[model samples]
Each structure stands twice: as C-alpha cells, then as structure tokens.
Target: MNLVLWIFTGLLATALLVSTVKAFLPREKIAATGPAAEWILDFSPGALRTIAGLEFLAAIGLILPAALDIAPILVPITATCVALLFVGATTVRLRRGERKTAVGDLVYLAIAIFIAIGRFGPWAFTS
Candidate 1:
C-alpha cells in the first residue's frame, strides 16, 4: 500500500506540475495541447492559470503531509479536493462534447477518490 501511494504521488505530482508549467507558458509553446487544454484556453488566462495552480498544489498535498508525517490527515483531504476538481473537469469536458477527455477525467476522479478513501480508512497513517 505504501508503494502504491508513492506511485500515485509521483505520477500525480509530475502530471500536475507539468500542467501548471504548461499553463503559464506562452500560447505558442503549447501548440499541441489536447482538446481539453484547448478548451481551457477559451477561458481567461487567470482562470486557466488558477486551475493549473490548484492542481499543482493538490499534487503536493497528496504527498507532502504523509511523507513528512505531519498532519497526514491532509492526504485524504487533498485527494478529495483533487477528485472534486476532476468532477468539474469531467462536467466541462462533457459539455464540450469531449467524450474521451471526459472519460479521462472520470478515471482520474476515480483514482483520486480511491486515494482519499484509502488514506482516510484502511491505509491511514499513524501519528
């Protein structure tokens, strides 16, 4: 279980950090962002950047607390928040007629939820 957590932490963190960096980069640097990223471009730059920043923070939240053994309860809370973010992402993707992207969001949402449940219950860390 610990190994699984570490895996998820690394994957999720890398993904989120990359996304955050991409969001801040110039439009030309992101010439081939997928349909979802293109859709995000439709919104204000601030909005897009905010989402990216939140994701980056959530990624850190997924790992830092548990890794440091300080306020480890935050792991579950962060996972729950990430799941909620993906729920919103899924909704937006569906609304944009992006079935594949929406499905991807659903997958992420599931993983985040799983982490939340596991960290909160069966795999909870001890003080």
Candidate 2:
C-alpha cells in the first residue's frame, strides 16, 4: 500500500511539473498550444504563474518530506491541498462550460483525494 501511494505521488508530481512548464510560458503561447490550453486565456499571466507556483510546491510537498523521512505527515497535508486545488480547477472549468476539461480536473481531484486518504490512513509513516 505504501508503494502504491509512492507511485501515485510520483506520477502526480510529474504531472504537476509538466504543467508548470507551460505556466512559465507566455499566456498567449499557452493558449495557442491547443484547445486544451484555451483556458489560460481566461486568466492573467500572474494568476497562471501563481497557480503554477502552487503546483510546483505541491509536487515537492508530495514527495520531499516523506521521502527524506523528516516529516512524512506533510505528505497528506500537501495531498489535501492538491485535492482542493483540483476542486477549484474543476469548478472553474465547469463554470466556463468546458465539460471536457472539467472531467479531467475531476480525475486529478480524485487521485489527489486518494493520496490524501491513503497517506492519512493505513499507509501513513510513523514518527
């Protein structure tokens, strides 16, 4: 179960890191990438960067403390924050009528929630 949670955490962190790349790009460049990126057009570059910064932090938070055994408890806390982030993402997509994107956001949310639950429950690191 711990291994499973680690795998999930690694994958989520990778996804967040990938997304962060686009966040550093110009908003126009991101929006021009494809239909999937069109949502960036609705946000200012600063807002997008802020979201990306959170994602970067979440990615690090999901792995570092736990991996280092310094404060594994932070893993679940970060996962919870990541879940909330996706909840907001889903809400925004739904409000914009981007049903397709909203579905993707919900999937990420579920994954984040799963990580949070697992880390906070049976798979949690002790002391």
lDDT of each: 0.80, 0.89
Angstrom error of the Cα, residue 100, model 2: value is 1.3
Q: Over the stretch 94-126, how does candidate 2's per-residue lDDT look in tens digits?
A: 888889878888888988999999999987889
The CA-based lDDT of model 2 is what? Answer: 0.89
TM-scores, each model vs. reference: 0.88, 0.95
* Separate clash counts for every candidate: 0, 0
Off by over 4 Å in 1: 27-36
Q: Find the 10 residues in a row with the least total lDDT in model 1.
A: 27-36
Candidate 1 residue 57 Cα shift, in angstroms, is 1.0
**Which candidate comes out best when scored by TM-score?**
2
Error of 1 at 6 (Å): 2.6
- Per-residue C-alpha lDDT of model 1 across residues 1-127, encoded as one tens digit per residue: 9678768767766666777875667654464565556665556778877888898899889888988999999999998998999889888888888897788788778888888888888888888
